[model samples]
Target: MLTKRIIPCLDIKNGRTVKGVNFVDLRDAGDPVVLAKQYAELGADELVFLDIAATLENRKTMHKMVLQVAEQVNIPFTVGGGISSVEDVDALLHCGADKVSINSSAVKRPDLINELSDKFGSQCIVVAIDAKQVEGEWLVHLAGGTIPTKINLFDWAIEVEQRGAGEILFTSMDHDGTKAGFANQALAKLSDIVNIPIIASGGAGTIQHFSDTFIEGKADAALAASVFHFGEIPIAELKKELKQQEIPVRI
Candidate 1:
């Protein structure tokens, strides 16, 4: 059986890890490097470090921060935010990022996905889509889920997969920070449309939410932030619960 993964995400702005409700009113959580090392030690399957201010601040991911965290953790780590060109992907890889996640950049230049996939291999390329429902239609949003895109979520997902994205990190803006549960309906539809691994993000509250995400939604992985960072859910215990529930997990 294929093991399901549990990933912890760090939304970094100004060098501090932050979390917010529905992607607003950001509050500081802690230092990214410190928190990242803790998560890795806690047995998180993977870690995502997103420079939430990178694009808006017109800067790349903090090289110093990423390098530090990469050195501190033994687990696989992915980095994102303001990754535009293949050169950007190369820089992050050189910084010890096992994978590079592209969002707004891929949406603006679709070919960048193919370019990175060709240069770094699909396993090193992750396409993260921040999407939200607008007027009853699930639309892809960009720039940290602040701008709406005309592209349909399902179609864009397929396009990225065709472009060789190894994984799709799908975060529903509506469910983001809500802690209600994942957007299973959308995630299920996306899983049917794309063959690449899908990491369901947002709306994760308990271990049961993780179970539903993979078993019912057909997601390859589940990603969360506050629940893990704030001691609400521990990865090892969560995996134990998932195993008891007959969910495929690394534990």
Candidate 2:
């Protein structure tokens, strides 16, 4: 069995790490560099740094900050937001990002996924899909979950995989920051739909939620923000408990 991954997300805005509920009402968490180092040393499997406002503000990810944070940790780092072309991914990788995540850009031009995976290889490309359920359909959202689309979440996931995306990061707008748990049902369905790994995001409040997402949701990884940012759950302890539960995790 593959070892499930625990990832801490750094949602950056104005050069500071921030967190919000349902993708609104942002608050400062801490310095990205400091938090990055702490999470790496604390046993996080990977780190994701997203410039949450870069797409909205129409700018590239802060390469200077990516370089700074990249210098502090030895783990694989993924950078996202305002990344639309092959040039942007190249720039971030040169700044030490092992992987690059694309969202709005991919949705706008689906061919971007093919171009990126072709240039950088599928292992380094992650497609982030932020969607929320509307009545009965889960529609994809963009611009930091501020805009909704008619695109079905499942359909997009399948298309991205077919385009050569290595993984998919799915964030549930409704479950985000609610701490209730992850969208396991949707995740399970996604896992069945795609052969690529799925990283479940949103609604992680307790350790049990992690286990549930991995087991029931069939997720290969679980990513969280506020819980780890606020020290509400320590990475080491969470991994220890997951291991005790017979979940495959690297200690």
Give me the runs in candidate 1 sitting further than 4 Å from their true place.
20-29, 55-61
Candidate 2 least-lDDT 10 residues = 20-29
lDDT, candidate 1, 1-251, per-residue tens: 88899998888887777774222122323667767776777778899988878853434438777888888888898988888998777877888889989999999999999999998999989999999999999999988899998999999999999999999999999999899999999999998888899999999998888999997789999999888877788788999999999887876
RMSD for each of the candidates: 3.9, 3.8
- Model 2 over residues 111-132: C-alpha lDDT tens digits? 9999999999999999999999
Model-by-model lDDT, in order? 0.86, 0.89
Estimate the TM-score for candidate 2. 0.92
Provide the lDDT at 168 for model 2: 99
Report how far off residue 231 is in candidate 2 (Å). Answer: 1.1
Worst 10 contiguous positions by lDDT, candidate 1? 20-29
Each candidate's TM vs. the true structure?
0.91, 0.92
